[model samples]
Target: MTRPPARPMRADAVRNYERILTAARAAFAEQGSQAPLDDIAQRAGVGNATLYRHFPTRQALLEAVHRDHIEALCRQAKELLAAPSPSEALMSWLKAVVAQGSTARGLAASLMAAIGTQEESWCRDAVFASASALLARAQQAGAVRPDVTVRQLLKLVNAIALATETEPDRDEQVGRLLDLLLDGLRATSTS
Candidate 1:
């Protein structure tokens, strides 16, 4: 299918857009969703007008950041699929999905909020599509259980992120828990 035409942006506008996103991600990582827009604009070295032109509202900016993260996770899934071991690739992608979902203090909640929204559903859909592709590859290789679904895997990853958000001191526990979850998904013959 032919791709739809994207609106052409001037070089300056494109740079401003990228700068805004980078600054917003850092701000959100430090201060959650409550980070000030003006601070983000200052950090980006752009005026409030420029920031507002790119993202009119706080939710708009948050959604954009979340969308960018989801896109990266999707790309990671594709790259992981090229690994020689399907089980290893799936496990690595699962860890990455959780990390992506938990990078910012409130990023997981924002992503959950995007689930039913008209403009933001594409982000959620893209995550699911990428995850399903990885899961299918592992399932076909008899590495993962045939009964497992992408939604279940995604939910589990989200839960892990939420559960561990306040306990950065227990990083090893997080790994063990994630390993346990992955073990459950393993096909009996492989286990």
Candidate 2:
């Protein structure tokens, strides 16, 4: 059966929710996913009860903080779909995915560790949809090899992120690795 739409938050509840999210973002950024919940509540100027009311668990809070970045990536994909060069757009978005994975450090990893094929999954679905659209567009334009799957591309980019995670000059390393990856995936070559 379909669930009824939930009621809206009251003005103060809405303010508390926004404040909690902002505090959570800063806390997570400063101390990774293991940031103290009490500190977050204090930072939000709310009691622990209020923080719990808004976000029951660390995973939930992490997901909410990461949600904006995920939405940004999805939006970029939609815009890149209109770019003149489909192949370049795909590569550009892939680089962004790596950048997200790289810069977010433990934030995404903690959320991803709890992620599975759950019915209400938002993170995986949004990312897959974004990548799939760019991949399909590039493949259709014959700029990228039709043999490539979004799963494979995601794996490679993730590997690139992991490989360069500890490097002092990560931007250069990621860029170099991406160029090598793109060279291999070019339509002019057969795997």
Candidate 3:
């Protein structure tokens, strides 16, 4: 039998949800995934019961935060698809991914590490599909080499992310590293 339609959330519930998510994102960014639930509730200006009602477990909250980031990246990739330059589009999305991977603490790393587990991470698949689409477009345009796979590109960017994780000047450092990576990714002119 088909399930019944889910009702839309009330205004107060929506506000609470947004508040908790905002607070949790900040807490996770600052203190990693292990940030205390009570503190998150306090930051959100909600009681512990409200926080628990919204997110039953620490893992649940962590997943929401991680999934939101991944979803945003996927959305960026989708938007970049319409860009006139395929190479530029791919590079733009890659920069965002690198920024995400290089996020201050282990929040991104921990969530990324959990993909494809028992949960059947649609998040991972969405990311791969978006990356492949952008990469394929650039490859077809002859802007990037044909031999480069999505996995290789992602691994390279993630390495750059990890390398700059603790750098005080992460933005500048990521930019320099990305330029080097761009050099390697470009299609060489055959005279």
Candidate 4:
């Protein structure tokens, strides 16, 4: 059996496609889903027609942005895994996740929308696996309580991100909040 021929885009079209995705990512980070496609096209130095050719709908563009951020977050998790200690690695990864969550307004909602689509869930799974591995290591070393789950940690980080908005010392606040969570995750003498 013969496979069907692959559709090939022109060199200029491929360049425009990449530019649109880059501009879309920046715009979504800055302004969320409400970011205008015309503005993205202008930023990419492509016409509206080119942007529409690459992404016909705002949902598609938003999904692309969401997927890109998720991938980057997963990559950060891999980097954190290389740190010396389980506690240090988990804390560092939590900080990175919190920072990403804080900056990406509407990200949680976008991610929910993208979850059940045909898009691969590699990024999401990678992040969870990374967190799980770190948490397991910490638990095994008696640095963290065994009861804590990655899901719980994620929820707490997201809550912190939502709560400290508009504070001039947001990063400091997040650090304090994360420290508190970490303390709670520590194994207790009575347990």
Q: Quick one: best lDDT, which candidate?
A: 3
lDDT of 4 by residue, 69-155 (tens): 666777777776677788888888777767776677655545444433455554446556777887888788788888888777766
Spell out the clash pairs found in candidate 3: none
The C-alpha lDDT values of all candidates are: 0.78, 0.78, 0.79, 0.71
lDDT of 2 by residue, 119-153 (tens): 46566777788889999999998888889987678
Candidate number that wins on lDDT, 3 or 4: 3
How well is each residue in 1-191 modelled by candidate 3, as lDDT tens digits?
11111457777877887789889888977876678899999999999998888777676666566665677788999999999999999999999988877654553454445442455555557777999999999999999999999878877876777678778998999999999999999999899
TM-score of 3: 0.67
Better model by TM-score: candidate 1 vs candidate 4:
1
Clashing pairs in 2: none
| lDDT over C-alpha atoms for residue 19 of model 2 | 84
* Stretch of 10 with least lDDT, candidate 3: 1-10
Best by TM-score: 2
Cα deviation at 124, candidate 2, in Å, is: 2.7
Number of the candidate with higher TM-score, 1 or 3: 1
Q: What is the C-alpha RMSD of each candidate to the true structure, in Å?
A: 5.1, 4.9, 5.6, 6.0
Clashing pairs in 1: none
TM-scores, each model vs. reference: 0.69, 0.74, 0.67, 0.67
lDDT of 4: 0.71
